[model samples]
Target chain A: MSTRHDIAAPPTEGGAAPGRPAPATGPTEADRRRRARLSRRWQRDLRWSPYAFVSPFFVLFLAFGLFPLIYTGWASLHQVELTAPTDMTWVGLRNYTRIFDDEFFWNAAKNTLMIGIISTVPQLLMAMGIAHILNYKLRASTFYRVVMLAPYATSIAAASLVFVLLFGRDYGMINWALDQVGIGKVDWQNDHWASKVAVSSIIIWRWTGYNALIYLAAMQAIPQDLYESAALDGASRWQQFLHVTLPSLRPTILFTAVVSTIGASQVFGEPLLFDANKGASGGAEHQFQTLGLYLYEQGWVNQHLGRASAIAWTMFLILIVIGIVNYVISRRLRASS
Target chain B: MTTTLTKPEDAAPPVRKSRKPRAARAGGHMHGGPIAYAILVLFSIGSLFPLVWTAIAASRDNNRLAQTPPPFWFGSNLFHNLDVAWTDANLGEAFVNTTFVAGVSALTIVFLSTIAGFAFAKLRFRGRGALMLLVIGTMMVPPQLSVIPLYMMVAKLDWTDQLQAVIFPSLVSAFGVFFMRQYLIQALPDELIEAARMDGASSWRVVWHIVFPAARPAMAVLGMLMFVQTWNDFLWPFLVLTQTGNPTVQVAVAGLGRGYTPDQSLIMAGALLGTLPLLLVFAIFGKQIVGGIMQGAVKG
Candidate 1:
């Protein structure tokens, strides 16, 4: 032991602290075995702990996310009712075929498209303008951002209800303001186009600031050096924005567009809570009904789970098609740029 | 555009360099113009006007709301209307139920996400890449696709109107995982973890002592964001929770909007009650949330 210490202690103490605390117990037989076991356990922990860390998310997601998605596809093939979800009879493509012929389904899809365009086009454009303004140096920027996000903080139910009061045909503050401004009073709920506009306005109010904030984030992420270099080259502010800011923000713009599109396609609460009498129908003539509301009406109101599943699947397919289209367009744009 | 230039240092040991704000940036010290302020003020007013109107409508009687011009100012009937709507719509119970659910969901999601995010950001493991891709892919799957089956599960398990109906499904968030992973990848230094390991710290010890402290700021931000999201979530809670039996704030407020009471003031009161909590949260945590969103957006 003394000879081994003479050989090992000098080397160990050379790079270590002036005096080693202790010998850390001699490398006796049991100690070596214990050290080996500890290393094995350490190696095992290193290799497997990551899986353990990530398993809960995977487990929950598989049960809640993936399984349900595939099951919805399965349930779409059978005749099932809400009253007895266990009961199933094979219907082949009857549900899909019926959805194709369903006039209300077509109308709902068309309204969804209309509202999506109405809300998204104006919203993104306004968001871009607002984000540009926000990116400028300002006092109390946080206050402005928080205030702008008020509508996002407001729940869809609450926002829709407040909007319903504001859009009242006879007594609404909006109509009164319009009258004061030399415009005639208009029926917002009863008129199909008016209802669509009002509903789209609610979406715009809720989301424009959020998208603006997102755009602002993207803009801020762009280094000021880019702008400085552009300025050195005598590029005007507009030119610099076009050349530097917009290009850097391409991915962010695409992200927001995809998110907003998904939101619009699955818009359920605004139209659901718009008019009480024609709640699920979206209006008296089902004019403002979206595919989401129509699905709810089919499954919950009419108790036809099978049909609703079909509708759900149809919406999924439509979203996939839209996603692919978006991808292709974005790719083409990227290549051209 | 400058990302390529900066990408090298990103993989280097943490620099601990703080990012300069836009005002401090050399070239662009210019403040906003008058037109910019005017537009921003206009937008802010537009953003806040509906909420203000809700209070005004709630404070006045139903008749006042149906008049030629809506009430533009507060009236004495605010508390009376609030009380009536509170009981009428079962909002008290809703507040309790929603708070508990949101709190539990936020806490669990934060905890789970941080660990998983650390794993993804720092650790080398099998299936990490594929798993992360799956998480991102899952974000694209709309809730409509899952709700039908979830509804079935809730019904079959006789969990209708229970908090777990909303809480369990919400315990996992793809965005939360992604957000935390992005934050940790930059926030945490590899040298720190290695030092801890050199000190004979186990992975568990490294997580508890090293990772958690480094991750605290992000954890707080994520928790608040998740709380707000779960609090405001409508579709699932509306389906499972009944208005009278058990309700979330969204469900209860919706019940009021469904014309349970024909009084418009009462409905406004409920809507105001439902939204006030979140607005207060936003008011207090506004800066942190703003920072968090910007941080998440950058390099995300």
Candidate 2:
């Protein structure tokens, strides 16, 4: 096996091929001994350096990340509340059982999945298209790329609030524009499906640019030779993209998909802001409620600690399952490739 | 490497032919071609319209805003609305509180992430591989899962309703550390550190002088992300900052929509104010923000 030095190149070094350079001359005995000693010292340093470097992350994770996760699992098994005294009572699986029967829980789960599908499918497809357009030679490409990320960089609270005004039924700019173009105003926040659509549009707008940039990077990494080969076969631009580029982007595609799914599952701020009229219930009917919002309302608003903890664990489980599925699919794709 | 040398000849024809259409279009003076400049101009306007509208709405009275085709021009109610929002919601307090929380949280995050990142990139220690994986693995665990437990922990510590509750939980971010590490590893050279070490500089001194300056670009990017995230964060602050006067901008904005019968102009004004700093940051460091985001995304 190659030594650690062989693998120490930065990932951005363009994956240089190995075994090309040969030593210029045979080493003298003294030089060989010095080199061997240096290598041994380097190996010793390598063994300890990585651990010291990564300790903060693990330390912080243990306190903030892993500990909280384990605590949530423990909290899920008890019947508790915010104001209730901390008494040890473990009703195993009862929290999960209650979740199955809870109408709000199911609504939140269904809404999460619905919004996930609505946002993820088009958001990614459009992102792929945008990335493709972006990858081509264009004037002011840098400016456009910068402008594209503005929405993502902007605060979610701010964007959702802007959308709230834009999607207003009576005096919204969108309705005003639509009226000019001979279209009628639509009630954006009142109706269940309409509100979801409105909320989903915000998600799509904010994230499409981010994912597009990711895809653009992956696209840049694809070998120019592959496109050249396809072109030599009399392939059109579309053909080259479909045959050479899209397949090359599968890993990134899966990555973004899983990440988007996780994001969608926890869709909070938009729905929270959008349903501001209903006072944090995520709508009067809870139509636009998601798992994250539901969890918040339960834990903080209603003070249903046990149920909220259960919902959180369930969301975590779902995310893990999705992540595992994504991993499996990516591995299969890699193996096949 | 072999493929790079061999493919140029084969690749030449298609690229040359593909250029023909663009050249033809340019020659024909097709000013508004399918890839129209107009579309770009329109989208830019669309992207910025809400902000423009907010300014107009903020300046207008409720009467004017309630007009059929809402007043597209400004009116003389900016001070009146500001006064009402201020007195009604104590928005001024919220602003101060928010600035404090976001500022402190961002500073701490930058400090911790930098120290941790430098160590990860340069320091030699045991169990580094497992620790690195552990940190990376935490990235996959959604924040929602931990919210409940974190809230409970905060409650146990009696830190609920305090700004520390908001700032402490947010101080450690995986992405911040990851980005800082990546940037430092790439931007800083081993020779600089070796020289610093030869000069009898301690590890901390070497990092403070050498690594920190080299990591500014990445620090700016991480700082921007953290600031925007903290400023805009809604759920945690909303939960912890149950006190009306202590609300962050988001919680305050959401309260505006809730406490009053949803006034478009007021909400627009508030939202506009909330988003202005972010927009300003983008405007100032638009290039850096773009480069950082693209770099971070690419690596991810």
Per-residue lDDT of candidate 2, residues B197-273 (tens digit): 44334455555667676777678878887887788787778777863647787777767666463566676677666
Interface RMSD, one decimal, each candidate: 4.6, 7.5
Give per-residue CA lDDT, model 2, range A51-161, as digits (tens): 544555567667877888888889899988888626536889998998889888899888888988988999999789777766665567667666777777656776787
Q: Which structure among the candidates has the greatest TM-score?
A: 1
Candidate 1 per-residue C-alpha lDDT over A1-337 given as tens digits, one digit per residue, 9 for 90 to 100? 3232222222222345233234475557775565556667777888899998888888888888888888888889999899987788899999999888999999999999999999999999999999888888887777899999889889899999999999999999999999999998989998989999999999999999988988887887678888888999999989988999899889888888888899999989999999977899999999899999999999999988888889999899888897888889789878978
For candidate 1 chain A, the 10 contiguous residues with the lowest summed lDDT are A4-13
CAPRI-style class, candidate 2:
acceptable
* B-chain TM-score for every candidate: 0.92, 0.82
User: Against the true structure, what is each candidate's TM-score?
Assistant: 0.93, 0.83
Give model 2's clash tally.
8
Q: Which ten residues in a row have the lowest lDDT in candidate 2 chain A?
A: A5-14
RMSD of each: 5.4, 8.9
